[model samples]
Target: MYTALLHQYQLVMSSREAVFNYLDTLKPEDLLKPVASFNNESIGSLMIHSADTYTSWLVNFARQESRPFYTADNYKDLASIRATFEQINLIVNDFLNHFKDVLDAPLTLPKKEGMELTLSPMQLFTHVITHEFHHKGQIMNMSRQLGYTPVDTDVIRF
Candidate 1:
């Protein structure tokens, strides 16, 4: 039952939770504070951007479902961002369930300029997760700029 993939994803979520836990320690104002070097993007916005990536790829592109992408204004606190991630969990579960049998198969999607994009379920899953980690690093760096030390947010604890 794809135990390795499932376990790896679970570890990703665990590391994500660690990030959230660290954010939880910060005051709301601090989380919302914008860092000028990152185009004034705050930690909250980066987190929301990560969630939007999950929703956009897994739900919208993969499933051909229409959903509004979240904005930084829509979620400024850990509570709301955490809630959005919970919804993302459901989307991810449905995606895995639907494509469990064909994760390696290519899924072709149409582009606006008469182009086509071909990617496998496994690729898309890897894309989103890695994308999140990329932003996770940004969030950590932003936190440091914001005068907060970051905790370990890697999939492997050691």
Candidate 2:
């Protein structure tokens, strides 16, 4: 009895799994190599940032909790990132499970410059999923520039 909203949640999770599978193909050190760009964001940093963004917008903000962002020391390796992401998955799953009846519930989101935005759970989930792929491109490009070809992270096949 999966509702339309539940399907969206499943699809977003599948999309992330596809990207992480692509990440697993690279050498562990390749994660740290610098990308040949002005931004100076390495693959690891971009990935961690993407995860942190999800935690921020989806988990913390949605829960009204203020937690510090992730750091290299806290999420040093692929395993660590996956573990943290798994925790995020749990949080997201819990939210979706209990709130399935109110997927349309409006959440008050605080923004910079003293702005507040009201968005439905569906809207926030979409933002986080898209935000992830935007950074996925940076990580993919950084890996290419670092001379380590990776499996295609493009094409949301799921």
Candidate 3:
């Protein structure tokens, strides 16, 4: 279980690094350019939303010791979105670095709605990475529609 959890963490980190590299290549104007399928949402907004969702998940995980899970409020502005992305990156890195501290701990996370349920640290970690991949797909499609070259970060490519 420990080795599996470590592998999951590495996958999440690698995926994030790849996506961030893609994000870094965007020009400032590119961040705000509207994408067709996303109801004309800027690429930055999608990035921010993804990061916010992950951060909210982790924050709830850390704060509500007995709570099952929680969802984040919708992001409204660029500043908030950027901050959330930064926060998510920082928090995930911290959690990864301190895996030993909570590796064996039981987590009570929220399920579909406000319902609470128990999970292992490894399960939660896996969810975090998988969740990110799901959103990355959305962003990739949006990028292609917007005439931008999407980064290829598929696991098989690595």
Candidate 4:
């Protein structure tokens, strides 16, 4: 189970890096262009939000804290989005390297009503990666809809 999970993690990381690279190929104006999504979220906003959620989960896992997910506000620019992505990527890589040792660690997370619930480290890590992938798919869809050719991110393709 551990080895399989590790492989999955590596696959996810690779896909993430590929997506980021493809995104980087876009011009600054292209990134800022609005998608037709109902949320009015631009490409940059979606990327920043994805990074924010992943980093928040990682930090919560590391600290064993009971906190709700982090939300970014006033991050309406490319610079802020890039900064958040770098920060999250750094923490994610660090966590992955030490994840085995941290597996047995206890963690707590807050509910919508402010109640705390505990989780094992493995559970936390699972949530972090899975959640990021879910949002990444959304970003990919938006990319396609916006007429930017989406990169092939399937595990088999990688």
Prediction-by-prediction clash tally: 0, 0, 5, 0
Misplaced by over 4 Å in model 1 are: none
* Candidate achieving higher lDDT, 2 or 4: 2
Candidate 2 lDDT at 104 equals 79
| TM-score ranking, best first | 1, 2, 4, 3
- List of clashing residue pairs for candidate 1: none
**Candidate 4 to truth, TM:** 0.71
lDDT rank order: 1, 2, 4, 3
Looking at candidate 3, the ten consecutive residues that score lowest on lDDT are 65-74
- Candidate 4, clashing residue pairs? none
Residue 84's lDDT in candidate 2: 70
Q: On residues 30-76, what C-alpha lDDT tens digit does candidate 2 reach at each position?
A: 77666668277667778778778877876677767776788886456
Shift in Å, residue 120, candidate 1: 0.4
TM-score of each: 0.94, 0.81, 0.65, 0.71
Comparing 1 and 4 on TM-score, the stronger one:
1
In angstroms, how far off is 146's CA in candidate 1?
Answer: 0.6
At residue 5, give the lDDT of candidate 1. Answer: 69
- The Cα local distance difference test for each model comes to 0.87, 0.72, 0.64, 0.69
Better of 3 and 4 by TM-score: 4
lDDT of 4 by residue, 11-119 (tens): 8778877776777776666666777672878777777766666656666546644445434542455566656666666776666666666676676666458787777
